[model samples]
Target: MKLSDYAKSQGISYRTAWHWWKQGLLKGHQLPNGTIIIDVDSSNHIRETACIYVRVPSVEDQDDLDRQANRLTEIALAKGYGVKRVVKEVASGLNDHRKQLISLLKNADYTVLMIANKDHLTLFGSDYLIILLDQLGKKVEIIEDINNQSEDLVPEFMAALRIFSQKIYGKSMTKLQVSHLLSEFQKQFAPEEH
Candidate 1:
């Protein structure tokens, strides 16, 4: 259950729950959606330095990120990794804070770090992912491309767009024909910069 809910159920406030955690009495995993799960048994592995870091494209994308993060977490848990703390940040590949990301990058206690793409691994630079990969000592597995799978809705939307265009033209629409038309339409009517 969530940390807040667990705290409420146990008749303690959230701050008290945090205090218990800081003292190594409570253990929790921070889910991508900003909820924390606490397990008494998991607390037993509490170490002064173990942790994990997760980077996402945006905070607004949390709704879409839950499934991908869940898959990665499942694999990590199955491998018997003791994950203590987690870092979640809304950072884009093209424009992210190198200093802020690196502050978490040089962690020495984490055994695994699940990342979305080469962009994430290269948060610091090509040398950084290599350095951390070497330091962790365990092979870094590149999970499925979460970003690509995230665009699955695009095909469905394209089909719908084809159907709409057929109605607009009072004729049938071929996937190829509709795609070409859509491309032209998009180029002509692309959003204007403010």
Candidate 2:
């Protein structure tokens, strides 16, 4: 089929198909006439294998990651995906080059990479992660913790920031300290109001 027809068949826009083609993510080939042909059967090998990646910045949180990841595993397994293994990161998500994450994306065995939240994956440039996952024919699954105090995005984000900061600094933050931290985080992450 032609590229536009193939994109229509795949339920994606022609531009998206073209972007995938440029990224080498679409399983397709170019003919001598400069037309693209998609290998409809090329992606059948992508079985849903779950590989959980947990981020806990301190020894205090390290002990709890297993329980959290196990809970995530239960959800994945319930969905019929085979559990691969849980990978951990002890560094700040603001840092771009994480060893375990880099290695895992290079790996082609798993169809899914599960994490507690997008924040647990990276503090910024999450689209980059998604694009990389797409190229590798994998996906990221986020399991929100049910026990969390708030369901609202801003409060939950601030709470997560507090937890990571405590682990990074190796000390419990005072209420006032958290207030200051939240202020700075908002300044950096959220646009200033005035």
| Candidate 2 residue pairs in clash (backbone atoms < 3 Å) | none
User: How many collisions per candidate?
Assistant: 0, 0
Backbone clash pairs in model 2 (N, Cα, C under 3 Å; residues 3+ apart or in different chains), count: 0
For each candidate in the order shown, give its overall lDDT on alpha carbons: 0.56, 0.69
**Taking the tens digit of each residue's C-alpha lDDT, what string does model 1 give over 84-170?**
344555555434454545765665555556654454444336456657576767345566576575463344346457657778986
| Candidate 2 lDDT by residue in tens digits, 1-194 | 57787666544357756766677766778999988877666461224777888876445456657877778866875565656667877665665677998887777777888888776777678768878887878888778675541332444455567767788886767656877988886679886578
Which whole-number lDDT from 0 to 100 does residue 73 have in model 1? 55
Return the lDDT, model 2, position 162.
72
**Model 1 lDDT, full chain set:** 0.56
The lowest-lDDT stretch of 10 consecutive residues in candidate 1 is: 44-53
Query: What local lDDT does model 2 show for residue 60?
Result: 46
lDDT over C-alpha atoms for residue 108 of model 2: 76
